[model samples]
Each structure stands twice: as structure tokens, then as C-alpha cells.
Target chain A: MGAKRIGKQTWKPEHPPVIISAAAVVGPFEGQGPFKDYFDHIYTDIMAGERSFEAAEKEMLLNACFTCLNKANRTPQDMDFFLAGDILNQTISSSFSALELRIPFFGIYGACSTSAEGLALAAMLVDGGFASFVLAGTSSHNASAERQYRYPTEYGFSRKPHVQWTVTGAGAALVARDGEGPRITFLTVGKVQDFGIKDPLNLGAAMAPAAVDTMVRHFADTGNGPEYYDLIVTGDLGKFGHSLAVKMAVSNGGFDLSKNYQDCGLMLYDTRKQDVHAGGSGCAASATVTYGYLYRKLMDGELKRVLLVATGALHSPVTCFQGNNIPGIAHAVSLEMI
Target chain B: MARDPKRKPLTVDQKRYTEMVRDLVPRPPYLRNSLLAFLFGGLVAIIGQFFTDIYRITMNMSVKEAGNPAVATMIFIGALLTGLGVFDKIARYAGAGLVVPVTGFANSVVSSALEFKREGLVFGIGSKMFILAGSVITFGVVTAFFVGLIYALFVF
Candidate 1:
């Protein structure tokens, strides 16, 4: 069997990689969220007994990775590659976890889209026969993200309605050459899109264009309409961005995403009750939802095919403050239960 | 909305998309927010007056002299609430009500101090303590200087 390239950006590998096992570890706040039962482990303390938020993020990622490996009955030495990323500066959470795991690591950075990005790359590696088993993971902490991107956690600054709360959690998945689990069927890499959005607080608006672009491209490449997938989920467009993406998809792409479309941000927390103004946004937003809740759905034969389009705002505080527009990216991975 | 002169001009498609997003995104409830701010701000003022009255009665100080101690007490309470992680939760609902008071200033300073304490005393707590409050202090002093200069020139 030969590997097939579809359309411009989508790829159909000869041998689709199987996600053998996956795990999600969340903080106390996220544990109280709607999808709490799906998560493998929930830390009662946000600090997770770590001295700092950064260390706690790393610990969550490490816990996720180990939980995933333990579920598959695989050890660290069995993994051919460990690809992970985080929203932190230099992706420290992932790199520190890689150091402890002692796996050959590929440190990636896609902001909030990191989980899907890692999954896509890990699938490619397995399909191309470069590796047998790969661990792809990502993590984000609300306090750490707030410290780096916005003001201090305790600051009495009022948030705008569009402002999203960063999720405090980590998610990891084990992709292998052959396994009895969900298979990565199609992958569509996204192009960075900027619509001259400058406000860092309104990341949903900044990121929606890229998500729509990727989804449209995925549909074009696969010749599959929105109805083909039982579920179509975005990474972290929150409420506003998710709506914008739906509108853009219809107006620009000539496709209706009114049905079978949801966002991880909206699924994670009950926005009405939670003080998270818009919704959750971070690397773990899509990650935990897909790996924990959605993965379980697939295993239970609830969903046949699901399209995961993880969106990201590729902007730093320095860049945003420097009067630069925020560019957005999204990667789509079609997962089919096998 | 007036475009920022410093920002690069958007392309036609980009401008159209931006307009679409702006229309689609929900606007903040100004009327409700204003009402909350007004009520909360009045409550804070009432609390300050209570403190001032207590100071006047106990220390035999003039109303003018009691004002400073009352403000200092408010700042102390603000710092305590911030440390307990309660002020931010209130600020979220109170909006400008809590943020436009002396308590907000204390929160700005204390929050930064607590956030950076892990880094150490000099570089973290000391330097970063003014991260948010620095702007307020800077503009406050500058405006005060100009006001003082005008008073000296016109009224003196």
C-alpha cells in the first residue's frame, strides 16, 4: 500500500496509526467541570503539591504520560518518540517532562493547538514506519498561563466577556503502528491566518479564521461533508470563536456546520455557572476532551467518526504588546474507531 | 471604531472579516455593569466614611486628618482580601466599582507581590510589586504636579 496525499494539505497514510491508550489529568477546578468523570486523575490542589504553578503543569503532563503508558502496559523505553508541547515559554512543561521520562523527544509549540499538532505528527511517524509507538502529549495551567500572558492570578483586573479562562490540565495519547483502538484516518495541516485582530483578550475572534480554514480544507481534501463525521470538535475557540467559525464555514466555505459541531471549550465547563466568562482555552482544552471524554465515546461505540480541529493563537505577550496582529493556526485529525 | 494609527492597515478581506467578527461577538452589558459599579462604589464610600467617623471619635482628629487613616485602613483590608483570593472574585462582578477605589490600588500591588514571591525578594516581590500599580502612581504624581503648579500660579 502506498501513502496517499489528498488535495493540498491533507494526507492519507498507507497504515493509519492506532491510539492504544490515552489519559487526561486535571486540576481541582477542571475536576469540577462537566467532563470530570472522563478524566483519569484529578488533583484536588491546583499546585499538585508542587512549589510553583510551572512545576505543577510539568507534573500534570508527566502524570498524563505515565498514566497513558501504564494503561497500555508499556514502559518509557518502549516508546520510540515522545512528542509534546505546552503554552509556556520554551515549552518548559513538556521539555521537563521529557527529561524525566528519558524518551527521545520532539519539543513542539502550537500554543493551544499543541495536542492535535502532536497527535498529527505522531501519526505520521507511525504511518511512515519511522517509529512503532509514540507518546504525544500537551499541558497548560491557568495560573502559569495568566502569569505569562495576562496579569497575576490574584490581580483584581476585570475580564472582558470575550476573555477565556485557560484550562489547568494535561492530556496524553499513545499512538502505535497497530493496536485495537481508534485510528487516525486523515490529517490536515493548517496555514496561519491573521485577520488583523490585535486584542489578546479576544483570542476566539483571532483564532476562528484559522479553524474555519482548516475545517474547510479538510472537507475539500477528504471529499467529506460536515455530515460525514458523527462529531466535529474544535480545540479552544470558546463560545464566540466557535460561533464565528461556524458562520465563516457557511459563508466562505459554502458548508453548513450547524449540526454535529461542538467545541472543547464549551464542553469542558458549564459557562453559565462557572465564572469563566467565555469558556476554557488552552492546550488542554481540546486535549482532555478528545483523549478522555471523546475517546471513551468512541470506545463505547457511541461515535463512529470524529473530526478534531484544534485551533491556536500564535501570539506571545511580547508580540501582542509590540502592536502585532495575532496569527492563528489549526490542525485537523480525523479519528475513526477500529 | 477609530483604528490605531500604529497598527498596520488591514487588507480588504481582512477588514471585512474583522467587521463580521465584531458584529457577531456579543458586546458587554454597559447598563447593568454601570448600575453595579454605581452601587458597589457607593458601598465602598460608605465603608470609608464609617472608618473616618471612628477615627474622628477615638483620636479626636479633624475630619480632614481622619481621611488618611481611613484610606490606609481600606488599603490594608484590600490587601488582606487579595491575599485570601476573594477580591478578584468580587472585582469580576463589581467591575469599575471595586477597581476605581483605593482597594483596587492595593490589590494591584499586593497581587503582583504575591505572584512573584517565588522568584525571591529583590527581583521578584520588590521589583514586580509595582507592575500594575506603577502606571497609577506615575500618572497620579504627574497629574498632581500639574495641578499643584496651576494652583500656585492662579490662587497663590
Candidate 2:
């Protein structure tokens, strides 16, 4: 199902104009290991050198925002808010970032789905007659995330291919409401789901069901079928999880997602670049796909209606020890030109 | 004047073009649109309920399955907000809307780090890598510890 935006040129709804001005990626999985060598290269090659993962992440996001605004010919002063987040405590990444922009800030936490959730909130604010000119974003890092979630690198824990590759990078996009840009007409809120899977190591399996659940809900709520949108994209659910999600959706939801399905993690690294057997995290997945694929498609008029689903593995190490598989969840949003 | 080979190639034309383009494009009035995006985003969620129903009735999926679609929808809406350029707008209007929920924080981190990548790897990629995820990781760890602590304190 694909949506074709009608009357896009002159149709500016009460909603503000929203468009992604620019995007960027920074990471270190370029040449780190044999199994996941190339993933580190993105960091080595794209970013240049290494630093504290947290520091690097902060720099990456700050740079992305600056570049995005620069591309749009706007400045931080032009923005009403400085929105940011990360998979960290106290949202240090975003908090620190706020210090840089010195603009009013909002910090959020949605696991990997942070990017999507941020966008949804911002759009709702626009639709509700609230303030405008907001900036929303999300990010992650391999070292920091791994150390926090599991054992530090010194522990030398072996990672399973089924496990998702934690993307040590950040991505950003500038959104504006309703004039001379893509207009977001709708968004579907996600319902949290725990499929009783508790393995933190294998996130795809944990998150697949959640992705299916949210997608099913979105379609049901909209009264739209798979035929309604052109593409259905999921956040970090990589190869295994992506496959599992499709199967679950068809078997459980009675809808086949094979025709129009993609995962951000799957897209982030060329399997050749990184040994990421599955998918990447939220920001890398969101940023790359949004800027790499979706943005281009929007520009080309190749797609009219798109159902983008970002999935997250909401699991804690404590839960894992408690004999829990990763808890998975997903959220949906609709993007239309009209 | 002799140009130093070590000075690196500088493109004045690209800089000039970027400036020209910036001045040429008109920025939107974000105050109004972000609110609309929010409304539209909410409406999308409301509409998603119908999709949830379909999953339940037609497909015999569980409430969880029915609701999964909306998760993706929500994230897409977030991206759309960023695209509309109103995400920044509303972030200014309502702080809670962006921070309290899981989504808003995600965007803040991802968007901020992306901006820093241009400075190059040492300064760009490596430096700005985990800005957003740091929180989730911390929360995951601390929450796990507390959750574990509680289990140990009570169940164990």
C-alpha cells in the first residue's frame, strides 16, 4: 500500500510545514574486528579519529544540527527549541548538547524509537496550536551502550550474530511545519508490548513482535490496509528480527508485510562494511534511512504515502538476568505530501 | 602570492553558493506549523486505533500486534516533524512534550550528534558518537540494577 499526496503544491494545512533540511552520521565501527570490522570503519573513515564515545556522540549531534540548519539557511537562533536525546542516563548527550545551542531544550527517552517519538511529539505540538520551530533528534554509541548494558570491553564478551550491532553514531534532521516542504498529516502512537522474550543479547527477536504489534495497530486505527502505503519501515530490527516481524505480522496480524518492508539497521551498514548480521540502533537507522532513502523518495515523487515503523528493544540487563528476553515495541507515523 | 601546498584546497565557490542558497530560500513561520504537526501526529495515533481494530478483528492479532503498527507510525511522524522544521518550533513551545516521552529524547540525541559529524572523525565522528544513547544505556543499566535490587530485596 502506497500513499500519493494530492494537492501538495498549494495545500498547506493548518499544520506547519515540516521538512528535513539536512542529515549526517558519525561512528567508529570501521576496522575494529574481523566479524564486525567495517562497522567500525564508518567511524574511522567518516568521522576521522577516536575519542570518548560520549564526547564523540555529542560532537556528532551538534555537528549534524549545525549542518542541517546551515543547509536550510537557518541558525540555532532561528529555531524555537533545541531537542535532543540518547540511550543514556540523565540524557547527558542531549543535556550537554543543550549547553551548546543554549536554546531552550527538551530531552526524551524512547529506547531506539526516540527519533520517531520526538518527531511525533513535535508534530502534535504543531497540530495543537502550540509553539513552532522545533528541533528533535536521537543518538547512540557502541562502547558506552555496551558498557552500560553489559560488561565493558575489557570483559571480552563474545557477541552473537543474532545480536544487533550497537551503532556508535548519531544522526539529525531539521523539521519544519507546512510551508514549502513535506507535510506530516498523521502519526500512530505505539502500545508497549512484552512478548515474554528476555534475551538482551538478541534484540531482533525481542523487538520483532513489538514492531508487528504497533504496525498492526496503526493500520487498524487508520482503517487503512497494506495497500494504503508504499513502504513500511522498521527501526532497528535487523535481518533476523525483520524476518520475524514479517512472519508475526502475517501470522498474528493476518497481513503480509513482505512486499513493503525494510529495516533501518539492515540499511545502516553494508553487510560488507560491518559484520552486523542483524540491524543497527535507532539514530543510525533513522538518520540513514530518512536522509538516504525516504528523503530521496519524497523528493522524487516516487512515493505518496509511507508508513514508517521504528522498533525498539526495551530491555535492561537486570531483566536479562531475571530470565527475560528483550522486550520489544514499535511506533508508526504517516508521511504525506498533501 | 605563492599558494602553500600544505594549505589544503579551499573552494570559495562552494562557500559562496551555500551562502547564496541560504539567502535565497525562505524560512517558514514555525510557531503555527509545529502545533499543527502535533495535532496531525495525535490524529494519526487516533486513526491508528482503527488499524489496531483491523488487526484484532480481521487478522485475529492480539492487542499488542494491533498496536505495533502505531509505533512505526509515531516514529515516522517524528521524522515528519523534523522534516517540517517544526520539531524545533514545538520544542520551544512545550518542553515536557518532547522530554517526558521516550521519543522526544531520542530525537534530541540523534539530531544533535548528526550536526557534529562534519568536523571529521577525531573531532566529528568519534567525539560526537554516543551523545543520545548514553542516557538510554544509563537508564537501562541503573533501572536494571534497581529492578534487580528490588527483586533481591524482596523476592530473593
Candidate 3:
């Protein structure tokens, strides 16, 4: 049997793929966050014993992948495909880590929404009998991202209150054909939505529309209401984007997601204590939260059903400098523990 | 500032959505930020004045001659604070207050130098040291030249 096509962009696989094992490895700052206990390994040094911040980011991704493979009692040779990405030039972290893993790799990029994108594709591969086990992973580092996108680490630039702090972490999940874990039941692919927001710093406002659009589409496609899932989590909308999503979902889609809705950006850090202006962002924001915290919740039977919508801002430094508005994208994956 | 001809105009729904987002997003506290900038900027000027006085009194230099030493002292202090990782912390709250002085220029150069030091000394630190401050220098010199040209041609 083949994968079933649902409403619009959603897909329902004939045999749902199982997320067997997931792991999260974070840097020192993320280790101090509220969900620190859920993470597998926490590096005290941001460098992760590496010389460059880029090298450190690669190390975190490799660590997460290995930890995930080990947890499932699987080796790198056992995996069929390695799907990974990061917020770096050419997705270097993923490609470099794939070099070490030696798994046939597919390097992807959806900005911060890479985790869900990988998961959806992994599920398709598994359900289609293309692979028995596929490793889906993604990572992002604060220093590396800052140096690439905004400024240097030591630059004395004042961040606005709406500016989000990029998360320094990596997360990986092993998706298999048969396993005793949460199943990937449904996936809703989002279209790129541009709201004509030009401020590169105000990412939350830019990405909110795409996140809401995906959420509304997911519900409409699956014929599920806001209350159908135990929890509905968005990738890195932060404070402003999360509220905007809540409002837009109601106004546009006629879906009230005021309850049982949380953003991984907000959940990853303590906004009051941590100096993260809005909240944590980057690819790792959703990857770590969903793979570590939400995965555990599913395993422990705490949450029977969950809708994970990871949002991404599709803008480059060149585009931003050229005054092009940032386009946003989001992909949703429904996890159900039968 | 004409709109880009290639870009399509915003639709009615898109315009309404933009308005809603504008309302939802929080605006920075401009009044409070301005007051902080003013207070801190005043403090920086006072410190500069003190350095100028010290140079004038201790070395018996003229006010005009002491100005160079005073500016140098302020820049040195700024570089030191930036190296110690204290300038950004203070700048977070001080806003334009800490950024309007010569100290801000020092911070910009030193910070870029420190950040790019990993790439190597010549290509990294030497070339990139002026990455941020180059703009200020270029524009400053150009504006000064234009002003002087105007004075030479007309007033002078």
C-alpha cells in the first residue's frame, strides 16, 4: 500500500512510521534552561571542546545523532538514510556529521523548521519501504548563527525586546518501520507565506502567519479540532509570534487555539530569568524540545496525541540586506502513541 | 524611495494581516530609552571633560591640544571594557548613551577584531577589525571634505 493523500498538503501513510529513539544535546546556556533535565548531554563550554563555533555546532549534531542511535541499540551501519540540516552555510553541520556517520545522507534546509521537515520525509521513506531506519536530525548554535546572520559574538550591539536568542543545541530522532514508540500519523506541508515584514530582527512577527497557516491547514486536513490533541506546539515563533499565531488562527481559520497551545521557543527558556529577550530560537529550538521533552512525554504516556508544527523564516542575510521581506514556512507532524 | 516596480502591491487581506501584526507586536519604550540614553550620554561627556581637564592641568597643554589625549583616553577605556566583556552588558541598557561617544567606535573596532581573530591575524583580525567602524570613518571623512569644500568655495 502507498501513502494516502489527505486534504491539501497533508499525507497519511499506510503504515505509520515509528520514532524509535530521540536525543537532545545542548550547550551551557540551554543546559540552564527550564527543560535542561530532558536533555541527554549538556556541554559546559559553548565550544564543545572545539576551536571554532562552527566546529562546536557540528560536534553537537554528531553527538545527538550518536546518542539517538545508541539509545535504540542501533549502529550507524544499521541506518539506511541520514536526514539532517542546520542554520549554517550549505548546511555544513549536517553534511559534515553525515561524513562521520557514513549513512547515505540527504541534507535538507527549512531554516528552523528543519526537524519537522526531516521527520515528514523520514516517515514517507519508512512507510514506502524505502528504508527500515532513517535518522532525522538538525542543530543550531548561538555564536555561529549570530556571526553568520547578525553580528559577532563580542559585538556591543543592543538587541531589541522582540529579538529572540538563538538556541545552542542539537537533536536527533531515529524513525523506523517497526518500533515501540510514538507513530508519525499525519503530516501537513506548509506553503511559504510572506507578510511583507522587512525587519530581520523581528522574526517572530514575520513567521507567525506561516505557523498559523500550517496549524489551520493541519486541523482542516486531518479533520481535528484544537482540542483533539493533548498539546499543540509551534517551532520558534517566540513570544510575539505565538500570540500573533493564536489571534490569527481564530480570525482567519476560525480555530481557537488559546488552550493546549505552546511554542517551543517559549518553552525552551525562562523569559523572566534568562536574558533571552523574547525566547529561544533557531533550528534546535523545536528539534530539542520535540525530540527530548515531547518525545519523553509520549513515551511515558503523558500525552497520547501531539501536533508539532515547526516554523521557519526563509530569509538570507543577502536577502535581508537587499530589503526583501522575509517569507515564512511551517511543516506539521502528528505524533500518536497507540 | 519609490516602491520597487517589480514587487506586487499588498492585497486587502495581507494589508489587514499586517495591521493586526503591527498591533500585536510590542513597541519599544521610546521615552524610557531616550531618558536612559540622555543620562548615560551625559555621564560619558562628563568623563571626557574630566580627562580633558587632567591633560590640560597636569601637562600644561592648551585646551585644543588636550582634546586629542582626552579622546584617546576615552577610547582606551572603551576598548578595555569591551575586552572585559562589559561594554555590551552596559550597552544593553545604555542604548545610544554608550554608543554616541568615541568609546562606541573603539568598541566596534575592538569587538570585530576579537571576533575575527580565530580566522588568523592578517586576514581575520587586521582586515576585519574595521568592518563596522569603516562605515563611520568613510562617511565622516566624506562629509567633512564636503563641508570644508563648501567653506573654501563660499564662506572662506
- Pairs of colliding residues, candidate 1: none
lDDT of 2 by residue, B21-122 (tens): 234323443554456446644655566677678778998889998777656555555555654556645554443445334445445544544445456768
lDDT of 2 by residue, A235-306 (tens): 888777777777678866798888988887776667766566555765556654664457657767888777
Interface RMSDs of the predictions, in order, are 3.3, 23.1, 2.4
The superposed Cα distance between candidate 3 and the true structure at residue B105, in angstroms, equals 0.9
Model 3's DockQ score: 0.57
Model 1: per-residue Cα lDDT over A1-338, one tens digit each: 23478898999978889999999999998888999899999999999999999999999999999999999999999999999999999999999999999999999999999988999999999998899999999999999999999999998766678999899999999999998888999999999999988889999999999999999999999999999999999999999998898899998889999989999988999887888888999999999999999999998999989999999999998888768899999999999986
The list of candidate 2 runs beyond 4 A from truth reads A1-17, A28-50, A154-157, A322-325, B1-156
Q: How much of the true A–B contact set does each candidate keep?
A: 0.75, 0.00, 0.55
DockQ in order: 0.57, 0.01, 0.57
What TM value does chain B of candidate 2 have? 0.51
The TM-scores, one per candidate, come to: 0.97, 0.61, 0.97
> Candidate 2 at A188: error in angstroms?
0.6
How far is A204's C-alpha from truth in model 2 (Å)? 1.2
Output the TM-score of candidate 3.
Answer: 0.97
Per-residue C-alpha lDDT of model 3 across residues A1-338, encoded as one tens digit per residue: 23498888899989999999999999999898899999999999999999999999999999999999999999999999999999899999999999999999999999999999999999999998899999999999999999889877777756678899999999999999998999999999999999988888889888999999998988888899889999999999999899999998988899988989999999999888999988889999999999989999999999999999999999998888766888999999999998
User: Distance (Å) between predicted and true CA of A23, model 1?
Assistant: 0.4
